[model samples]
Target: IRILPHVHDTGAFFVALLEKVSPLPGEKIYKEKDAEEREAGESGSETQRVRQPPKKKQRTGFKEEPYFYFEKDEPIWPGISQFYDMNPEVDPTHFLSRTNDGKKRNLYFTNKLVKDVVTLNQDHIKIINTGVKVLVRSDNKGADCDFRLAQEGSQVLLPLFKKRKISITRDDMVTMLLNDDMCEPPEIEKMDTKTQEQCENLESGSLAFTHKREDGVEITLVGWKGAKSVRGYVAKHDRIHYLRLLNADTSKYEKNKYQEQRDLLQKNGSIDDNNENSNEILAENGTTKNDDLENGNITEVKENEIKNNENVDNEDNGNGNGDRNGNDHEMEINKQTG
Candidate 1:
């Protein structure tokens, strides 16, 4: 039957084992060395080795041996005359094992397989077989006290203990760490005086007014409440008006009649004294004309009365003569007698 070998660097003796053996009846089965014997042998102590038990016959076609052991550097193979040392108490399942000498431990793979184990002493240790180069780190004091076993050309990760919570995913933290612009805050724009006035003039409790210039151009402004009155007429060249409301007493309408009369007289070129004298002369002329008319009427009345008295006397004489003529001849004799 063919035998296969598996070898690895463990900084100790390279050990190999074989299993699945067939043995004859009443023949002794192979046995490997126990830990006590191996320890005695390593120390060069001479002692009687224990003998193996003979194999017993079984109903099966062949009986299997438990295991057969061999050391690679040693020249023995399948030789059952002497027993090979084996560490029964040692846990083969572990990646590392301590030697029987108790001076050091051997890596199951290699010293480098265990990370972060620095070499503390050089003479106390040995490297048997390794897949890669082994680096021996030494301090200046020449007494190394630590051992670092790891894969060759591989990085070692040190154990780190953090005492505080770290922010790993916050956007702000990431931005700040990266020194990016994402952490900058937006800027606010400032308002100018004109803009502020316009805003104040807005219907939202803002004071504002419009002013007209001499060229008829208009401008609006905002001011404090009750600061100034905005009611006034603009002059021809003025751009603003400032009329205000106030309480003032009003007077009644009056006519200057005396002044009017004086003006009329002046226009006519006449004085008050000249006008009075002219009116008096006119009155005198009217009185003289009325007296003359009265005198003429009295003289006509006297002439008419004289004419009437003459007529009356003539009538009386005529009547007396008639009577005398009728009685003249008769009355002569009577008259002579009387």
Candidate 2:
């Protein structure tokens, strides 16, 4: 056994190597008693005693919806096969619907392996759903096709569609993606000459728009062509994703709250810095004025003290002069008396 240390936010635990050499002394007796009880219960030996009735078996789990694979001669296959110019090699049996009835809403596509698995184990297991949605029922009377192509399966079925598909340029793809209004899709005339020419004869329905780069990277998007306008059928998130792939600007869709907060802080910080700088400047000017006043007051006091000292010295000198005069007169009088 080994006990592991709790470090780096991990829990303390232990591991042990266990081995079972023998069973307990009462294990065999217990198993025999359990078997006897099961046998007695199965044999209905206690029918004399009153017991509750067994509950009826209840069905559980998800409801099973069987897949209905389409045949090559199915009535709905003709319209789709003719509209999309489906390749003859592509079998219609690969497509399926959830409904067995004639009213099929969506058609899904599956590869060989998935198809085999679903077909073989359909009766034994419950399959919730399988395959990619390739087509959906669009009951528009104006549309030539009954079903429209779905974006979910566009990549898988792109090569199988020869008609209702056009090659567009990077700019045209960007223009279609940027048009947010479904009612006012970008007009076909506004696109480049090649795209306009390619879409001239196309009917108002689903379309496959493909763009290839110089580096052999290709992108395929499902689109819808209206009477006079066309637009991409991609979702908002997918629109951003494809725009990123095409190296187009997607700033309109991307929002970063963190970056916005940082920008606001920087602007406020600049204002705060300006305020601090002005305060510092005012403080510096006030200090210089205070120093000048203090120096001026000290100089005035020193000048006043010097004037008082000079006056005192002049007074003393005059007193001494007077004393000398008096002494000389007294000496002359004494000499005359002698």
The candidate that wins on lDDT is 2
lDDT value, residue 251 of candidate 2? 85
lDDT of 1: 0.28
What would the per-residue lDDT of candidate 2 be over residues 161-257, giving only the tens digit for each residue? 7899999999999988776533345778888999988888887777889999889999888866766677666666777888998999998556586
RMSD values, in order shown: 69.7, 29.2
Clashing residue pairs in candidate 2, if any?
Answer: none
Candidate 1 lDDT score at position 166: 18
For each candidate in the order shown, give its overall lDDT on alpha carbons: 0.28, 0.73
The per-residue C-alpha lDDT of model 2 at residue 43 equals 54
Worst 10 residues of 1 by lDDT: 156-165
lDDT accuracy of residue 56 in candidate 1: 82
User: What lDDT score goes with residue 163 in model 1?
Assistant: 14
